[model samples]
Each structure stands twice: as C-alpha cells, then as structure tokens.
Target: IVSDSSVLLCVCISLCLAWLHGDPRKVLHPTDSYGRFCGQKGTPNAKKPILFYFNILKCANPAVLINLQCPTTQMCVLKCPDRFATYTDMQLQHKLSKSYWEYYRQFCKPGFNDPNKGDFHIFRPNLLMCVCVCVCVCVCVCVCVCVCVCVSYRGLLISLVVSLVFILLLRFTARLLLWFTIIAVIFLLAYGMWYCSMELSQLRETPGSDVAIVDVGLHTDLQVYLQLRQTWIIFLVSLGLTEVSILVMLIFLRRRVQVAIALLREASRAMSYIMSTLFYPVVTFFLLAVCISYWAVTAVFLASSNEAVYKHTFLVNTFFSLCQTFNRTNISKTASCLGSQCTFAFYGGETPYHRYLFILQLFNLLVFLWLVNFSLALEQCTLAGAFASYYWAKRKPQDIPPCPLFSSFSRAIRYHTGSLAFGALILSVVQLVRIILEYLDQKLRGSNNMVSRFILCCLKCCFWCLERFIRYMNRNAYIMVAIYGKNFCTSAQEAFFLLMRNVVRVAVLDRVTDFLLFLGKVLIAGGVGIVAFFFFTRKIPVIQEEVPTLNNYWVPLLTVVAGSYLIAHGFFSVYAMCVDTLFLCFCDDLERNDGGSEKPFLMSPELHRILGKSSHSRISPLQILLVWDKCLPSSNSKMLQVRIKEPKTTEEMCHPSNMSVKILSHSGHSISRGNKSNTTTPQVYLLTSHPGSVLRFSKKDLQSTAHLIFQTHVHTKTA
Candidate 1:
C-alpha cells in the first residue's frame, strides 16, 4: 500500500507542474530545432519559465498564442493591445489577414488604416465593462423608482398631467398654424390670379408695341414681335393648365388632394420631432459631405474619361448654364456660339461623342443614384433610431433607451447595402429616363412637328406620375426597413399593404399634411424673398447706387427665393421623412393592436390619449362603455353589475323587450334579465357571456335593453 501511494503522489505532482506550465502547443514564442524557446540573443532570461514569457505578451497581439499560463500561485492575466497600433507583417499575415483588415477598416475603425497616418481609436474599451455598468445603473434606477412610487405617487401623477397638458397645447398651436397657412395660401393664390388677369389684359392691348419701344439697336421690330408672341403663348398655356388643374381638383380629386395634404402635415410633425434631436443635424452634415464628395468623384471620372465629349455636353455645362441664366447674360451671344463652334466641337472625338456622352451620363446617373440612396438610407435609419428611442421613452419613461443614432446608422451602412443599392438603382434608372426625355423634348422644341412633341409630352407626363408614385413607395419602404429590419422589397411590399389597408385614413391624412407642407414652403420662400428685397434695397441703399449695372431687383429676388426654397427643402425633407416613418409606425400599431382590449396601443400614450379624446365624441356611449368594461379587470364586479326593470305588459314579455345583460362572474358568465310571464312578471336570466348565447331576437328586443347598475344607483332606469 505504501508503494502504490508513492507512485500516485508522483503522478499528481507531475500533473500539477504540467498545469502550471500550460500546454507546450499553446506557447506564443517560436521554438528552435531542439524544440526550445528562441530566446533573445545574449539574454540571461532564456531559461525563464514559459508561463512568465506568455504573461507579458499582449492580448490580440498576433505574436501571442491563443492560450497563456501563469504560476499556480498567480492568476493568468492578459492586457489588450491598442486597436490603432501597427502590427508587424508576420503578425498581421498570420492572424489578421487582408480580408479581416478590410472588415476592420470598414466597421471597426474607418480611416484608421491610411498609410500616411492612423485615425484616433474610437472603439469602446471593454464591452463587458459597459454592460456591467449599464446593468448596475438600471438596478439603481429601479430601486429609486420604487422608492419614489412609494413616497410621492401623487406628485408624479400631477407632474405627468402637467406635461401632457403642455404637449396638448403645443399640438393645438401647430394645428392652428396649419389651418391658417392653408387659408392664407388660398387667398394668396386668388389674389395672384386676379393680378395676373389684370396684367394679361393690359398686355393684350399693348402686345409687341412695348417690346419694340424697349428694343435698342440690338434687335429689330421682327425680333420683338417673335419674343412677344412666344411670351404670350407660354402665358396662355400656363393659365390654361392652371385652370384645368383647379377644375380637376374641385370636381374629381378633392378627397385625394385632402388626403395628400394631411399626409404632408403628418410628415411636417414628424420632421419637427426628429429635428428636435441633436443627432439630425450631425447626420445631415455628414451625409451632405458624403454627397458632395461623391459628386466630385463622379464629375472627375466623367471629365477624365471623355473630356472632349463631356465638355460640350449638358453634363459639364448644366451648372454653368444655370449660373449664366441667373446672371442674365446675353443669351444671343450664347445662341450664336451654339450655332457655330459648339456644333463642330465633338467632330474630332475618338468615339461617337453622343454615345460617349451618353455613357458618361449613365455613369454619373449611377453615382448620383448611389449617393442619393445612401443618404436616404442614412436619414431613414437615423430617424428610425430617433423614433424608436422616442417610443421606448414614452412606453417606459423611467428607463429610456440610449440614443441609437450612430449604432443604427452604422448597421444600415453595413447590413442594408444591397437594399439601398437596389432601390437607388431603380430610381436612378427612372430618373435617367426622365433626363433623356427632357433632352429629347429640348431638342424637339425648335421642331414644328406637333405629333412628335405631343407624344413626348404625354410620355413625360406619364413618367412623371410614375416617378412620383415610385418615389413615395420607395420612401415608405425605407421606413419599414428601418423599423422592421426587412429587405427593400419586403419592406416595400409591407408598406404598400399597410397603406392599402388604411387607404381612407392615409388619403385624408396625406393630402391635408401635403397641403400644409406646401403652404409652409410657400410662406417661407415668399417671406424670405420679400425680406431680402427690403434688406438689399432699403437697408443697403448704397449697393444700388454703387452697382448701377445690377439694376434688376428681379435677379436678387429670384436668388433669395431659390435660396429659401433650398433651405425649406432641406429643413422640410427631414420632417417629411419623420412623417413617413411615424405614419408607418402608427399604421403598424393599428394593425398589431387593432385598438382592442386584448392589445394595448403601441403609440405614445400622449398621442393615443389625444387622438382618443378628439374622436371620442363621435363614438356611441354603448361602444365606449363596452370597450371600457372589457379592458377592466373582473375584480371590479361592483362596477360591472347593472339591473334592468322587468316589463309588466304581455306584449313586452312576448317581444322580450328591454333586456339588460350584466357581467356577473370571472368565468365568462353574464346575467341577462327578461320578463317571461304576463301577470307575475318573473325575471328570465341567462348565464353565458358569449354573444351567440342569446337566442334569435328582433330589433325591438335589443331596443328594450335598459339601464346600467352601479353602486350608487338604488333603482333601475331605461338606458
């Protein structure tokens, strides 16, 4: 027995030594031919324990192995390396390959791997530590909440009511503004029409006489006549179109228009909500930089690829042309150049200049599409995060979720690349088609062939309508993707279905919202233009005298208007996106909850409460009582009980009139009373709660149902 014990002790000691040393295969240092450590030259630590060697090696250092060891008396420890630190080729090649670097650069640290210099590391130090901290905070919060609830529930209730009231007041103010703007727009349009009619009538009397008098040595009477004729034609056509639009709106599409306007209003509200957060401006600026960069890159590519062809094409000259037009430069000189030098500019091109220009335009179209799509996705995702956070905060006011803006934005850029690209590609193709049609129309404008022009016009109109519809659908689809994390197609289909299901609501809300937004845009742009005019003319009077050549106030007015439009678009686009997102969310909530007792509303309590109050007056008392009762717990039997007086007449008994049902017990049982006898008037009671439990009865039987019973009521009365 002693001999066997000695052998077992020896084995146990060996195992302990092995464990302390750890497995040889797990060691990080390279071994020599004799399977010994490749020690530093002339170092006395060559024979140091392998456990100590690994303990100093950094975590995530490719030079280090998977597992490390320490002496049995000490704990094994590893220090994480700086993520932004440079690694040796050997280290990176072995552990962090090229593919891994690509992923790391994209998701882990963008712009970090630039050869010139590494960016600052922005990653969280330790996920585990963060999680632990968050958990502790939540626990503390819960404890604090419990104490508050126990101590001052009444105070909390009062505060909540005050907040809700403030919100209601703000909502009311917004609605009043919306209605005021709509009425203002209508009046403005009417006044403008009256002014236009007066001007046109005056113009008809004068015609080319005024133009001839204004024409200097530059133009003859013939040129004046042609210009006046063209102006008249354009004005008449515009007036006719406006009249047609008004007729169509008033006669056939009034409801649809209203719906569109409502949708716009909703969008505006959503925009206000989203912009209220700081994340919006940050995301907007970032996206704007990205878009500008993309545009520059695309322009460079197009210019570099087909320099000669692109130089003469609209692709290169479009912005310049707009600038020239805005500056009111001599169009006659431009026209002369177009007829002479510009016609032969592409003659010496290597490729068919038109084809090359077409290809370059196509490439640009794709780039623009990608930029727009990416920006849209970014905005949608950010808004989604904002909406989600808002919703979560509303649902659990004490435990608000963290701002998910960056996280959601990153997720969208990473996961939804394909969806974004696909959506953008579709829209880009449609836009390209529109561009082509416009180019064709411009080319054919000088042609007198009415049939071709008419055909082009019809095609353009159809495509314009189609484009608007697709754009709207695509936008809503993006909202769905943000909320539900679905692919583009699935999200689009779901959005379409949701819209269809709530068509009436969507129509009414959409039109009203759109009109409100339109009114806001007009007000903003017009107000800015008017203010700018006064500022430039009256405030800066020296500017008019100093720059006499710039005599036209029209140019500055138009510039201000254009600038205001851009500003409004930027500001309102965010609101529009918010509206779409929230509307979709509201629609989703309706589908999921159906305003039933079985499911609570997913909307914010304030919104739900406000909407309920607004619409409550329209609902019948029975519906309100029934729905309220259904939502209540069965423990409130005193409130649920209702008594109806038995009828004394034989005719009433035969008809079984004025029967009232009272929910009596927790087992889905109800007590229904009716008079079954002519003289004694014995009460007939039913126990089942189901609607089907009642026997077939005429309308008269239901009409006779009576008063509800309550604890305060001493006698039954007719309902």
Candidate 2:
C-alpha cells in the first residue's frame, strides 16, 4: 500500500548519509577564515566566540566574486573593537604609553609580540573600525525568556482563542463574518490612505521634506524616507489602488461571494462534526520542523568538510598559497607594502570526497524539499478523507463514521505514502529548479550582461507561476486520491477534468472563499498587532506596570503579530480544505444523482434548498388528477370524476392513447399493466409516502422517470 516504497527508501538512505557526514556545529557557530568554529567549547578559541576580519575593506576584493568569501585575514576575538585606531598609529602611541599596545594586541594574531618585524607598516582607517555586535550570554538568555513569556501569553493564548472563535462564528454566521471582514479590510486600507495623505500634506509645508527619495538615495535608517513627500505619495497611491481593486472585485463578484460563503458554512459544519482535524496542523508542523533541521545539519557538515586553506597575497598583486607553516619571518618576506599577509582563502580539498560536497548539499536540499511537500500533501489527503466522510453521509452525525480523522490519517500513511511521495517529488523538482534560477539571478546581479539577467528573471518568474499552479493541482489531486483511493496521476487527471467541467464555479466560488479567508487572517493579525503594540509600548494604562521594559519593544510586538497570523492561518487552512472538499463533493453529487429518491443527493438539505434542487422522483396521482381537472374543459371534468378504492395488488391503468397510470410498489418495483377497466372506481395512493418505501414523489411533471397523469378529451364522457 505504500505508494512509492522506492522513493521512501531513497529518502531514508539520503538522510542516513547526511547524518553520518553532517556536523551541525558548523552552522550553529560562526567560523573563522582558519576553518575553526568560533564559540565551540573544548577548543582553543572557546573563549573567543566572535570572528573578526583584520582588514574589512580587503573583503571587497574582486576575488570574492569567484570564491564567495572575503579575501582577508580573519581571527577569533573575545569582543568587538570599540574604538578605531590604525596599527601604525597604535605602534607610535605604544612607545609613549603601554595602554595602546595592550589594546592593539587584541586585534593581532596569537603570539605576535613585535610590530616592527613586518615590512608593511601602513594601515587604512577603515581596517579597524568594522565592528560586529555581540550579545552576552546573560542578555541573550533574558531576551529568550522575555520572548517566551510574551509569545506564550500574548501570542499563543490570544491566537488560539481568536482562531477558535472565528471558526465557530463561520459555522453559524459565515455570511456576516465574511462581509464584515471584507468591509474591515477596505476601511483599514482607506484609513491608511487618509493617514498617508495627511502626512504628505504636513510634510509639504515643512522645509527640506520636499526632496525626492531618489535624490536622497538609500538610507540605513528607514525613517529618513518618511521625511520625503514622495514616500507618502507612493504609500497613498498604493493604498488607494488596493482599496479600489477590492471594491471592484466585490461589486462584480457579489453573487459568487454569496455562494462561497455558503460553501464556507458547509465546511464549518463539516469541521464541527470532525473537530479532531483542527489539531492536525500541529502534526504537519512537527514533520516540517524535522525536515528543516535535517537539511540544515547536513548542509553544515558538507560545507565544513573542507579544511582551511590559506592564500598569501602580496600588496603588489602577487598571490601565493601558504602550504607550509610560516611565522613572522615569513610575513616580512610577503609584506613588501601595506596589506600583505597570509589570509585564509577558501574551504576545499583535492580529495574525491571533498570534490563532491556540492552535489551532496544539493542532494540534501532536494530531499528536504521533497519531505516538506510530502508532509503537506499528507495533511491535505487526510483532511480531505475526513471531510469527504461528512459529505457522503446521508444523516448528519449519525451516519458519519467515528474517528474519521484517525482512520483517514492511517489510510494516508499506510496506503498512499508512495503516491504522496510521487506528487511531492514532482513539485520538489520544480521548486529546486526555481531555487537554482534564483541563485543564478543573485550571482548575475552585478553582471553587465543584461541579456543573462533578463533571461534569469524570466526563468524565475515562469518557475514561480509553475510552482503555484502545480501546488493548486496537487492539492485537488490529493483530495481526489483520498476520496477514491486512486494513484497520483490518475487522481490528478480526474480532478483536473472535474474542475474544468465546473471551471466557472471553481473560479468564482473557490477563489472568493480563499480571498475571504485571507481577509480573516489579515484582520486577526492586524487587530492583534494593534493590541500588542499598545501593550508593548505601555500605552494601555492598566497593563503598563505588567509590561516589561525592553531596549526595543518592537521585537516582541512583531513576534506576537506574526504568531497570531500563523495561528489564524493554520486554523483557517482547515476551513479552506473543508470548503474545497465539500465543493468537489457537491459537484460530484450533482453529476451522479438527479435529486431523486432512487439516487438522492447526499448534500445537506440547506444546500439543496439554496441551490433550488430536490430529490423527488415522481408526481402523485391525486395531484395529477387535480392538475388535469384545472387544465381540461369543465364538461370532461364533471363526467370523468376520479375516486379512490382500496387495491389488493399494485397495478397500472392505461387507455392506450387517452391516458396512462402506473402504481409503484413499496419495494420500488413497477407492477404490470392491468386490463382497461370500465368501472368508475379508482385507487389513488401516494407511492413515495407509503411505508417501507424510501422514494419521494415531486409535484412537477418534468421527471425523467414514470409519471401519473390523465389525458383529457370531451369524447370520454359521452357514454
């Protein structure tokens, strides 16, 4: 039942190799150019956790383009340099004061005592000013604790409550909630436009604020852009366009939105019955975390496999590999001028194993992507199966199976693993190509060849769209696979056609539902963000004392906001899947059954009513006679009076061309025709309402099945 046992085996083998060869320390700790991991315990550089570049400007050397590393001397340091002082300046000051030498020694390599030994003495001012900020252990632990407290109380707790309430609201008041969310989003955007306009108007009156952002160029402090009038204008225009777009969509697709809301209501009902599905995202999150951890560890090990190799660069453009151990005496030989030193170049080797590390890392990436996608596919399939049970059941909760989520999950893991892996593999391949294209784009960013850049950009965009389409197709295919237990390719084909057959509904209903759900997420995130901002900023008077004092409160505020959005998304994702499954099932129901008792619709009665459909298979004889009397002439109606008589057996009465009547038995079987009777007695009974019969008769005469009616004419009463 494992869909692709071979693929699973390959995954296992790849992970095993990765675990055997990978060392995660390379990623967790910074590494010096000397190939030693900084901050690692039980090492010489254990006390020196920070890696420092001797000449930061030399990092801009053209060799960086080829080697992907700065071509400069790097060393481990205990702390960053707080003050800027050139080696030459420090050397002269050292003679006047011992403090200068003590301070300068921290920047020098280990065991270097005499500064006069080197031939090069000149040092650039930029060489020593580059500093890397390092947080102390205590501070880091404190921040971690604070972040945990904030996320647990402000983020997780609120998000969980909000998400549950939102889902429940959707079940009973889906239309109202969806419309409210849509309106709120529009108003929020409108408010943003107004605010931006106000800011722009005020900035126009302020001198020096009229400068264009382009003239100012880029700034490290983003607040500088706010001072420019053009920035606010751009924001106002962007918000205005967004507002208009949403309004236009709402106006044009109002009916479709209503349908989508109805579908959401159905989905909510499904989720209400299968409450276990709301927690399935936790399982998916755990699986994804495992995959990401494995990939990171393997990549680190593969990268660290290369030992430190040093390259000695002379100030005059000559380069040599420092293959042998050398000391200050060797430094003098290389230092014909300033900037000459033995620098750690790149991590690599001539061995066959080291040569293939790139391939191994790529392999690691591919497996990671495959596993991530597989986990998502498995979730989709499991949720689909659970909701599918809800859709197919005739009775609401009584007919639905118990523990549907568990059964569906078991089925997905036991039988559809291979199929899930197959689908994930196809997507993984496309994603890997997109990643490669992105990498190439980044590499070509500095190139003068515009054609190559354009080509890479096109490839990137094409692959992006391709990934989106594939993801959509894969989701629907997994749903089909869950319902029918078909192979990946077969299910994909079937789902594709099913969607194509109802392309209009697919476009209008499904997308509108998604849009509404997205708005819900944005609303939750934005509302929570506002509350967090107030709490973090101590703007809420009641909670001011409870708020922790932090150097930057935005950190925790952003954490809460992002956490809320993710939580909301996870909960709403279940809702979205439910809607999609029900929609697909609804379409299938419409196609396979004609709303007749023989093949009644499996959809809920509410859905049937909303769609103006019924399952009745036939019209009753009494109702038929009433219609006949009304439509026919009065003389014929008086002579041909219909009366009821108890019958011993089911029978059909027909007067060849004049009239035809059939009686259906309790077992849904049609009886043979009886001889044309001259007696005026008539047996009129409802076929569908009879005990032991599941059939229901419609009042309409348009049924494709047998009907009860009388052909009326004046000649019938002449006798």
Candidate 3:
C-alpha cells in the first residue's frame, strides 16, 4: 500500500511540475499541487529543458485523516482517516484516519453564510442612535410649544415631545451635560489614537501570535478596523475642524441665521435632506454595533481562546465607545445581536478574560455618551439648512437655457471617457486583486508563515481566475455565463476603460467654474488683508514696514501670506462646495450619462476612429445642470455653465495655455437660454496652483453671484 501510495504521489507531483506555471489550470487539479505544473514550453529547438521541483508528502495515520502534508514537501496527501475511511476514501486519498479529518473539518467555515455580509454594512445601537438624535427632538418640541426654539427641524421635537407628554423623562443640567460629553469624547479619541498609533506604526510592536490584523473595529468586529483606518483618521480630524468652524460661523452669523429663520417658518425641508445624507455614514457602522450590543451587558459572552478575536473585540468595544460617546447612550442590546452574528470565538477554547472584554464595551459606551456634545455640535446647522431649503423651494421658478457657452461640454467629456473602457479592464482587475490580497494578508497574523503562504497561494489562484473572468465577461458575456454560469465584470470593467470617473468628477463638480470662484475669493480676501496691514502700518506710520528691525518685516509678511492662503483656501473651499452641490444637482439622475454623453463603451480603436471620439467622455453641461438643480432644492430656478470648445489648432486643443472657457449663469431668474445673443465675450483662462482648477477673468463680472461663489467650497463640504 505504501509503495502504491508513493508511486501515486510521484505521478501527481511530476504532472503538477510539468503543468503548473500560473493558476488558469487550478480547477483542473483542485486538491493536488496543480500550481507545481504551470509553465510554457520555449522554442522546440532549444537545447536545455526546463526543470521544476516537486515536493513529496505522506501520512502514516490514514484512518484518521483525509489529507496529510508530505514529509519531504508540503504537497497535499490524498489520505483517508480510518473511522470515515469508507466515506473519505470514496472522496480523496486513502491515507489518514477519517476521525482526525472530521475533527478538523469542524474548524472549516460553513460553505454558505449570511448574504447580507457584503451589503450596506451599517454599524450599531438603536437606542444610542435615538439618543444621539435627541437634539432633533428638542427642535420639534419647541415648534409644538410655539416657543422661540432651535429644535423645530428634523421632527425630533415632535417625537420627543409626544413621548414626554405620555412618559417619564430624564434630564440633565446644561452645564453638566456640556462638560461631561466633551471630556468623554476627547478621552476616547485619545485612547483609540494611542492604541492604533502604538500598534500599527511599529511592526515590532505587534505581538507574536498565530492570528493576524488588529491595529485597526466593533460591528464588523475585526474587518472594520482592518479596512477603515484612513477613513476614521480623516473623519476624526475633519470632525474636530467641522465642529469648531460651524460653531464659530454660527456665532458670527447668529443674527443672519435668525433673520433667515424668521423669514421662513417652514424650514424643515433642508433639515430633512441634510440630516438624511449626514446620518447615512453613522448608520453603516452603528448597525454593526447594534448586532454586538447584546454582548455589552454580559461579560461571559466575549470569552474567547483566540487572542486575535479577543483583541479585535476589544477594539470593537472601543469603536462603539466612541460612537456612543458622540450620541450619549448605552448600546448593550445592539452588542448582543452583533455578537450572535459575529460568532467570535477562539478556534481551540474560550478566553479567561472574557468578562473583562464585556465590561469594556460598557465603559466605552459611557465615555462616548458623556463626551458627544462638547467636542461636536450634532445639530448646529439644522436651522440654517431648514430655512435655506424652505425659502428656496417656495421662491418663483423660471425657465431659460441661461448658459449657452457651456452647451455640449458634457457630451465632449463623455465621448472622451467611454471609448477607453475596454483597455482599462486588465488594470482594474489587477487593482481589485491587489485590494483582495491586501485584505487577506492584513487579516492573518504576520508571524504565521505557513498560513500566510497558503493564503497567498489561494489569492494568487483566485486573482488569475478573476482576471481571465473579467476579460471573458467583457468580451463574450454569454460565453462566460454559459461556462462560468454568470457574467459579472462588464459594468465595472466598462467604467474603467475611459477617463470616465475623472471626466465625470470634473464636469459634475464644475471644477473649472469652482477655480474661478476661488480666484475671486482670494482676490477679495487678499485685498482685505492688504488693507488691514496698511491700516496697521499707518498707525505706526514711521515703523517702516519693510525694515527688518524690531518689527521683523518678514514676520508680518509671512503671517499675511499664510493668512491669505488660509483665507483663500477657506473661500475656495466654500465656493467649491457650492459648485459640487450644483454639479450633483445636474448628474443626480443621469447615472449612465453622469460623466458624459451617454455613449456606450467603445471596445476597439477602429470604433474610436470611426466615431471621432474624444480622449475622455463627458456628459452634457445641460444634463449635469439639470441633476444639480434637482438635488439642490434651494437653486431650482438657476444654473451655471462653463464650456471649453475643442480648438481646431493643436496648440489650443492640446495645451491648456490656449484653452478658453465661457462662463454663463442666469442673466435673469431662468435657465432657458436656448436663443440668447452674445452680450459679453468669452473669458480668458489663467493657470493656478490647483492643476485642474484654472482661474478665469476678473471678479467684477461675477459680483452678482458672489454668494454662489462663496458657497462653492468643495473641500469644506467634503470635509
């Protein structure tokens, strides 16, 4: 039997060595070392033949194993364990005992799992979410009571008021509430930052372990920390700035906000829309938290033998703590359900410190709830948005093709991008494979060389199949579906071929228009700054501003320059945000025509030549304008367009230096500018530091739309 098994192993190894070069043939050799046989034959006339190493392996206990690692080589042994030898040998090798293999089989993950795993990954805590939204309740309550109130937006006041009228309520002193929330948030964030900084930045700091990936969650439990490190760091930083800026802006614009609010009694529309969009981000993570919320109350639930799972769970509680702190609530119920779905347990046994992990979630929650209000203003702009939406929507609507110069701009962009979708398929697949491998590698322990190798091999094979499959799906969808049973990559692959994403982003963003807005903002801000400096200089008229004496001329100059940059950036950001809102209004519904002219993807260069396609695809300016208009309930009657023609001369077409853009907004209250004559000439373009956003002609021409320009900040809105 041993001799037969040896012979069989030799035959498999030799076949694998001959066949394995890559993974296109993995299916052909599912269990054996098929990878060993992948390669290509060189010229038939070549003198030397290529050689490959074939590792050998054998198992002594056939009755207790289905497969075994070869002693000499890590080749899989086709062994059948004894207890299930009858059943196991009928499947694979007749080497190992079935009992041993069966025992190990229990460790393998179930073939099928929750399909919702990949869909809409929301995090947790229903009660906590409800608590976070209490500010909304206050608004509604104020409205119902006919009080001069801030809580009339978001329907929160209505919900809370009704609840209070019928049920007992708990309240806190305003001073105590503010102080507690602030202290707790800063504390949690500091701890999280410390833990992640300590573990992730230093590779040596990671503990020696069999399991992997912890430097980064609660709901996904493990994977969240692995994937969302960059996003969270950005969010935390942005959150601080946003809260601070909003509060400052509110203080400065309080009377303005109040006046605006007074003008519009029905200021709920903007509040609803803004809140909905803002809430979406939290919903994803919070749902994950709720699933684990049940584990919050009980300490025994988290006991795990697997140190990786244990540590990861600790991180999850930490994350949940942050979230809960932001809102101020306990999320034990959420933890329980997530705990069930996560099924986090050690592979061998349970943890001794299980109880400690459970309480960690509670402590984290307490901290999060306590710190939320001070560091973050959860509802600062609710009233402003409410007024903005209500006032804008109730205003008169007009119709005009207000911007003729921007006509066909989007179609040009679309034509350029849609043509290249096919060529980018390979690159996209490669990128996707890289993402997958990175994910797998991060999830496993860095020290487990064997597991890492196994994972890498599997991923390599997976990626090979995926690449071919993407190609196959793009070319012959039916053939791929007929053979692989389904076609999947065409839509995704098509999006990559052209500069579709870039073109759409730029056009929908009205990036060039935004640049013009930023230029104007900088000009005004710089002028103001110069005036202030001059005023300071005159106060000490003999101070000689340029003389680098006690007054250190460079200090003021540097400060002014830095201050100018900051002001310019701030203004630019505001303008960019408005422009984004405008662009989004245009492309909101034209999903296929979003980036460009709704052209089908072009596969061949011949098609491109015949069609006379542009280098990138773009949707029509009008199309985008319409979508943006729809999204922004405030600017229903207005639209702006900037169009650059494809210049006949190579200098004009190829170099942005010669490119001219025409900016047109409503001459009146409508956008129906289909038959307008030329009142003013096109604007001259100038380059700016922002590579894509070039400046346009003087600010005097766009003074009327100054408010629009001020609100056009992309950076601020995104932040």
Q: Which candidate is the best by TM-score?
A: 2
- Cα lDDT of model 2 by residue, 1-719, tens digit: 23566666766776676566555555567677667777788877899878787776676654343233566666778888777766677778878889877776777765466765554765444555332543455578677767755544666678789988989888788888888999999988888888898998899789999898889997745678889999999999999998898899899988778877777887888888999999999999999998898776666556655655766655455434433345323553434343455656687767786677677767778988988999999999999999999989877789899999999999998888888988999899999999788777777889999889888888888989999999999999999999999999999998999999878778877778898899899889877877887777779998788877665665677678778899999999999899889888877777887544367667775564344223231222112212223334465342332322222111111111233335443333444344222222232333332222222223232233243333233334334
Cα deviation of 94 in candidate 1 (Å)? 86
Question: Is 2 or 3 the stronger prediction by TM-score?
Answer: 2
Q: For model 2, give the 10-residue run with minimal summed lDDT.
A: 647-656
Tens digits of per-residue lDDT for model 3 on 607-671?
Answer: 11212212122221111010122243244433333332322221221222222223343342211
Tell me how far the alpha carbon of residue 637 in candidate 1 is from the true structure, in angstroms, after superposition. 15
Error of 1 at 24 (Å): 63
lDDT of 3 at 412: 18
Displacement of residue 469 (Cα, Å) in model 1 is 2.7
In model 3, which runs have C-alpha deviations exceeding 4 angstroms?
1-286, 294-584, 588-719
Identify the runs in model 2 with alpha carbons over 4 angstroms from their true place: 1-8, 22-31, 36-50, 55-71, 77-80, 91-121, 125-132, 135-152, 202-208, 211-231, 310-344, 537-542, 609-719
**Which of the predicted structures, 1 or 3, would earn the higher TM-score when compared with the native?**
1
